[model samples]
Target: MELHELESAWKTLDAQVAQQDVELKQLRTQNLRMRMRGKLMRASFGQWAQLGIGLLFALWGGSYWFDHLGTPHLVAYGLAVHAYGIALLATAVVMLLHLAAVDYAQPVADVQQRLLTLRRTRIRSERVCWIVGAVVWVPIMMIALRTIGLDAWLANPAWVLGNLAAAVAIAAAAAWVMWRRPAWFAKLSMDGPLAEVERQLADISELRA
Candidate 1:
């Protein structure tokens, strides 16, 4: 759907998140263990979903990568095809978040210490991404620079830049998704009540503070 529509859907969920917050507080007072377990379930569920998404995309991307362009595809063509891999790879990344705004409402389904724990875990995941970028992306970047050099790479570096740019955009979008609906980020990227979900998520967050 369109961005604004996504935002609106997100808003509805945001309200739910706030409502969940109150429910969680009540659960804490009513059933401490259930509340904690609920959090654990939510966290585990999110991670599992994200792992599945990433694996699916990467595998699909790999298939697309080796799917074959033609009887004699050049390196450029290969790279272009591989750009799909990058996009899929980006989709696979699951930001550490446990909000149920997107996840439970439509198809699937967290708590406070649980929220905090999930947040901490999410932070670590981002760090891991950063680390992975350094270990994997940097070497490739250096090679890119060497091959294309300062001038050539700079001039119409669409091939090199497209992957990086897509990655950056995906990362930013994923980050936002995680904050608002970690489960949604894990399950789906392009869709997932983004418009309403975002609006609700914003309101939920605002309500919290």
Candidate 2:
């Protein structure tokens, strides 16, 4: 073969290689975007479902309270139930709003910043959940004890002290469990995807640079 013909063949092969590289990069970017969208959708749906359930409970509690409006004592009891439901709904709404605020089309740094903000929010929300649980549990336990005639039993000093200790123990256990539960679940659903997206965004930033 002529030397020029050999050179031409080599150039053709190089061009093909370059073209394939471009195509492959494009495919990878597309795949990453699809995965990111899937993560976002799943996270959004899960949050919405949580919020929806909370809203339902809140409404149920509200209805019960309204029905007992004339009964001041029962109305007070109803507030304990509403306290938990309202806290759950509020926290979920805050999370959803924060997630919605993230602009997916933004620059990598901006997206990362938003995600970090979200992580902080989740941490704060988890703490708030425990606090709310602790505050609400006392009334819940009181209501339960009342139903079992333990409220009257508490007229005795010893019985009152024992009941109060039991209530405190139950509340502490519940708060600890509630605190750990959401963090564990978020590791699988929320934190995992957020971290993956951050890594992907970093890669994209490097490529752009």
Clashes of each: 26, 0
Instruction: Please report the candidate that would top lDDT against the real structure.
Output: 2
RMSD of each: 18.1, 4.9
| TM-score between candidate 1 and the true structure | 0.32
Quickly count the clashes in candidate 1.
26
lDDT of every model, 2 decimals:
0.46, 0.70
lDDT of 1 by residue, 49-109 (tens): 7566555544643454365445232233334334443543443343333443223222111
Clashing pairs in 2: none
| Estimated TM-score for each candidate | 0.32, 0.66
Q: Write the per-residue lDDT of candidate 2 for residues 38-141, one digit (tens) a residue.
A: 77666678778878877876776677668779866556656767767887888888888888888767766787788788877776776666656655655556
